[model samples]
Target chain A: MAKYRQIREDLRALIESGEYGPRALLPSLTDLTARYRVARNTATQALKELEQEGLIQSEGGRGWIVRPRPRPRRHGIDRYSRSTWAAGKAILIAETASQGMVARQQIRELAEVEAPEVVAVRLGIPVGTTVWVRRRTTFIEDRAHQLADSYYPLDLVEGTAIRQVDTGPGGGFARLEESGERLDEINEELAARMPTSREAIDLSLPPGTPVVELIRTTYDISGRAVEVMWSIIAGDMSSFSYRFKIPD
Target chain B: MAKYRQIREDLRALIESGEYGPRALLPSLTDLTARYRVARNTATQALKELEQEGLIQSEGGRGWIVRPRPRPRRHGIDRYSRSTWAAGKAILIAETASQGMVARQQIRELAEVEAPEVVAVRLGIPVGTTVWVRRRTTFIEDRAHQLADSYYPLDLVEGTAIRQVDTGPGGGFARLEESGERLDEINEELAARMPTSREAIDLSLPPGTPVVELIRTTYDISGRAVEVMWSIIAGDMSSFSYRFKIPD
Candidate 1:
């Protein structure tokens, strides 16, 4: 029993060490059996344990691959402030691409859904205002992990390129930046909740995976709320940090 | 249907307006019906919707009571330079109570756990080092919302008052201050992930909420990792911001 457990731990170590990058398939069970000098049955046991632990998944004839993990992206914490963007200089930007992480996603726009009353109030808009909602599902190695829905006031972004939803990743924010609306202030309300059935399916989460919710209101130079982004991230694979200087 | 939804929305508004705080039971269904000029059925429907939305929970004998809605605990955007702390004494001191909005959580020290492989690598310590793992939870409305499992080198904090841990709530850094270690640098990594079953239960999450994972390494003036604080926050209920200056 201990040997099986040890093999599982060792396999986990390889995944963590980036020996098998995100979404990379692992060696076959036959290969594993030869490498570790273990019986074929023992190799099977090790693979089963890894699958149960959410470290890897089997893809039919494709063999097993490292479970999609959120490659931590570190942006210059300064990029968030209005002052930093004003300078418009190249600063340190952390990319998961260098780590070879890929996410599959679909982005779509919804018209005229009744904005939830809680959201309506937060925007100071009348209930039932026609709000443009952008919805997305992000996948890792073909497995769902994040679901995000952003609501924008129809009048503000209507006729803008934002209306034509971009199916590619990172489209919304990039398009908004191109439109010359300086994202001035962002007020974010973060929370957590159990996944609804749809969320569970969309995130490809196991039966009980909880999701982090980020409700963000991005403002213009005048500090008027122009865009509200609601992001749901998989809880197990991401983290966040910010840097601030104490006010003089 | 609209009228009933309106009543529900209004009732929710009243509750959020703090007319009824957490653990405050609603008026009898009869009274609410009279006040809203709606039938008992309509009032009951409103209550049911609220329950489904997780704004209130019923505990058998206890009719509907306000559920503690997780709110963002403001994380100031500022640099941690010693001069900054000394200069902003007044503003810094005033923020101690967290704007008097969210309730503070108390933390205590229990038995310490040995270093895990990842922590060992981050701390630049040998694997299996005897690092003290301090477990604590932050509470709001008598419920835990933030769970921290911090690892420290026993040699640094052992025999000092910090190893004893505070029986209740206070800033963790302030405790270190007493021990003559002034925090000069902090390196933090932030990511998002789905919460485990234990995290969901401890945070009182409804079902599918994810969590924000923050790993912070605090160094004293000499630039060594003294304490590694790992914080788990309900993703939907938290937002992080920080401001820093470009070095001249």
Candidate 2:
């Protein structure tokens, strides 16, 4: 395992140091295994690590190739501006326009279910209380890049459009506002880890790929918990930027 | 590979479902390989993946043991609050205290050097301009948890403690303030990926361990860039919380 990591380091340094430009093609897995005199799995793991870094990709039948595309920064202030959504936009996919990639959204399901243990705690509701749950997937360039499950207190959405398959322009955020649950604050918590098998299957992530799990809690202007969202963001392609003033 | 993942998922579900509690011992790697009828490397990989998730740990001669400690949320807003460090504290260490862990810091190096391309761009300085570079590593319970490199323009820190091995009580932030750079805002750009070999070594991370890389840009009250910090936070152990209000 140590040997595998060492080989990956050497190749990564070469690629990132500009010795190999955008068109650089990496050595085949077979070539690496033979050169390093290690098992094929060793070399494959090394390549998989780079693929998880967004440093290389398998070009059809060809071997691994470098990609020079820039990863877009999801700016917190700009992306979350009330104006961005009030103008009728999907919050997460709005920034994708600059990446020159087509973003496709699929509303997997809209259902009313008893809140799970985790969701209940975040939404300040009883574990068995019914809540409006929306599960959605986002695809960029035909590749699933994000998966989200958002839970809203049933009381806040019982007669609102938020319970439907499509919440229309601006999605749920706008709907919540029109219903008097004007969002006052959003708290986002982030962590990273190896993707679970279920997540790996859902995102079609490569081996060794990690996912950024973001738990977001939204509160109404009166500080009432309105919605709690859990999202798995593709680690290799997603980045977040936040601007905040340091409190005295 | 599929077999390995299948085994991992099954065992993970069992643990999470409370079939095995915090102190339960996992089957040995050899036992897993034999039971699953797979290559030893495949079994090792599966176990390594779990270790990266902070679910289990190798207890030396005792083999792998389960850990059920809740991952503590690292409140980003409070950590950067002036009141946190004003009382003579390291902001990051302060948050770790809530986890009941002791943070030991090592001042790796304090030097003046020409800024790297990335640092230069963030600092709004020439590529080869001199800067005060401070690299430090933080450990919790003998395990490295965070690695950070902070850079400041030489002109701003030439006569401050920020260029010393230990920047007194509040570290560089205090020194920056003492030098007339009253920090008013900070911007953190976050991304996740498998750790580079150097980062893995610095943090003593396991295979498949992904790190949350935060690039923080600090600006003074006058909106002039004062410092740019790059930090690699331990993936499974640390979580960041950000609280922001939607503007009218």
Candidate 3:
């Protein structure tokens, strides 16, 4: 094997074995070169390969550190269970708490804006129709993990808390139910894609990390799409699980 | 805005407006340079940006062409409904037919191998247990769209059609049902990440493309894990939709 590839494999094994835990720094380039009896460039090449594999990241002059694999936020069907949210348990808080992390939802932007073409179609509203949008960044352990933008038709939430920055307690769905909407079903469409530069910056994603785009439309008893939420979640930090019966 | 960014935005608007449809060739470097009155490098930078955004790809000496946005395979819950598959309707065939395309499943490998750790854990079997693995690549219109590896316990499928390269009619699930193990439910876990070099090559993925990893476990009526299938799907070519009642 090439000298650099051998070194990379050695380091990869160490990282995978958890000898170098998350955020743990690897040996300095000089040390690696001396230890492996290789040139400085060869040592650098080894680290670069690992970085490209999303294993470790260079900390500028401080050398490379193992990239922390965040506890994946599992989005199970039960997360949206009406009983859980209706009882005043916020899903984000409950999720993070179970993982022993603090959670915070920052209301980034809340305003009445013209609905985007995609959002309008999901909400079954007219193109260019005015809608109340509440955009927020969900943070786990002070690190941004998700960007969610929720849109509601102006007429449906004209005076409701869904138009506010903070929808309180059980979040927007509970508020919708209080207004007599009676939440019934949710349709989620998921796609994986390379994040746009803007999303990469907002989510602090590592290079080579993709993001999962989830568009969830919640419907009421009348089968009207009451809320449409678009979420961009750091793919490395999340997994979604769905359980369903085999329909006849 | 910088000159390259300005040119990029102009091209983006044109592409978005469908003036430059999928697979349509973009203006040549020389044509762009002359029209924009910019240096060759500036024009190159603009095209590079579009490539990075996954909107275009270089065709060697043929210049750049808009990347074809493959008709996304929408995986609704109905795809797995018993009626759809039990009636001899292969989901992939039905899906591509609806999109006016042909579908083919290429069975690349069939072997009895020692179960890997993750597969064993999901299958509730001991590690290194001998299992049957059927590996296949699903192609849409002759383009590889998905790679699926399905694992089954040897004892369960030792004499079944699942051990064959062709599982006939309804595929492995159907054969399992015919063996008297009635299918009950499915649990799917999904994540997204940049593909490995091998996966990228197998999928013919372009730069900036990601892959969605879906690990699905099928349970029998007795709640035993009958099969575990891991699928790697080209992210840009597919979307998964799941609809379910909001659990009480």
Candidate 4:
């Protein structure tokens, strides 16, 4: 095998065996060169290969470190059950608590804006209709986990607490229900893709990490779409669970 | 703004505006240099930025081309409903037909192997217990879309047609039901990550593409875990849709 490839394989085995655990620093390029009797470029190539494989990351001057693989937060359909959220349970906090992690959210932007084309279509509103949008970044263990943007039609939530930065307990759905738009169903679509440079930085994602885009539309008992939420979740830090019966 | 960034923004706007449609090749580096009065490296840098953003691809000697964003195939819970698959409806073919696209599957491997740790856990089997695994790559419109591997307890399927490369009619589930194991429910978990080099090559994924990993466990009415399927779906080519009532 090529010298650089041999080095790469050795390092990969080490990482997989848990010898180099998550976030643990790997030997510096200088050390690798000295131990393997290879040039600095060869050592660098080994680390670069690992980075491209999403196994390690170069931390600026701190050198390469095993990319941390946190226990993924599992999101079950039960999170949307009225018993959980309507009782004032915050979804993020509840999920994090199960994993013994702390959770918080920073409200980034809360304002009334023109509904974008996608949001309008989902909400059954006219193009460019005014809407209320609440954008926030959710954090777990002090690290950004996802970006959520919830949009509501102006007529549906104009003067409601849903327009505020803090929607109080149970979040926006509760507020909507209290306003008489009791949520009856939810339609969720999930897609995964590479994060944009901006998203990567915002989520502190490692190189090669992807993000899952979840778009959910909540419908009232009267069959009206009341709220549409778009979430960009850090793929490495989360997994979504769903259970359903197979209808005959 | 830097010259390369300015060029990138212009190209991005063109792509977003549909002026440069999917799979459309951009101007050659020479042409770009002449038109923008810039060095070849500057034009190359602009294209590299787009590639990293998952917007374009370098086709070796053919140069850079806009990445084709095929209309994603949406998967809903109904796909697993007994009415769909029990009628011998092949999931992939039915899904593709809905999109007016062609679908095919190539069975790569059918054999009995010791269950891996993850599969064992999901199947409620002891580690190293033998299991039957069927591996296949699914294609849509002649492009690879996903890799699926289904595992069954060896003892349960050892002498059955389920071990065949093609499980006739309703696929594996149908045969299992005939064998007295009626599926009652399914548990699905989804996570996304960068594909390994082998997976990337097999799926023909672009530089920045990711794969959604879906692990589904099927349970019989008796609550026994009967089958576990692991699917690595090409992120750029698919989305999963699910709709359910918000439990009261």
Q: Could you say which candidate leads in lDDT?
A: 4
Displacement of residue B94 (Cα, Å) in model 2 is 3.2
lDDT per residue for candidate 1 within B18-115, as digits (tens), equals: 89898898877877778778888778767766664456777677677877755555545443434444443322233434456434545556566778
Q: Candidate order by DockQ, highest to lowest?
A: 4, 2, 3, 1
Scored against the true structure, residue B166 in model 3 reaches a CA lDDT of 72
Candidate 2: tens digits of C-alpha lDDT, residues A1-248:
49898878878998878787786898888889888988988888887667656567788778887765435436465677788788888776786775566787789889988999878998887898998899999888788888989999887888888888778898888989988777889888888877766788899886556789998899988888899998997887688877889977
How would you class the docking of model 2?
A: medium
- Candidate 4 segments whose C-alpha is farther than 4 A from its true place: A1-21, A24-27, A30-53, B1-21, B24-53
Q: Clashes in model 2: which pairs?
A: none
lDDT of each: 0.62, 0.80, 0.86, 0.86
- Quote model 3's TM-score for chain B: 0.87
Supply the global lDDT for candidate 2: 0.80
Per-residue lDDT tens digits of candidate 1, residues A143-188?
5656767787777665665576542223444455556665556665
Candidate 4 residue-wise lDDT, A63-180, digit = tens: 9899888888888888787887889988778867877889899999998899998799999989799888999999988889999999988887767778777889988888888888
| Maximum-TM-score candidate | 4
Model 2, residue A121: C-alpha shift (Å): 1.8
Candidate 2 Cα errors over 4 Å, as ranges:
A1-23, A29-70, A73-75, A98-100, B1-9, B12-23, B29-70
lDDT of 4 at A182: 71
DockQ of each: 0.17, 0.64, 0.56, 0.65
Report RMSD (Å) for each prediction in the order shown. Answer: 11.7, 3.3, 4.3, 3.2
Scoring model 2 with DockQ, what do you get? Answer: 0.64
Model 3 agreement with the true structure over A1-248: per-residue lDDT tens digits: 99998898889878878899999999898888998899998898688667755778989988899988777878888888787779888978876687677889999999989999879999888889998899999998888999999999887787887877778788888888888899999999999887766787899988667889999999998899998999999999889999888888
Give native contacts recovered, as a fraction, per prediction: 0.32, 0.83, 0.86, 0.86
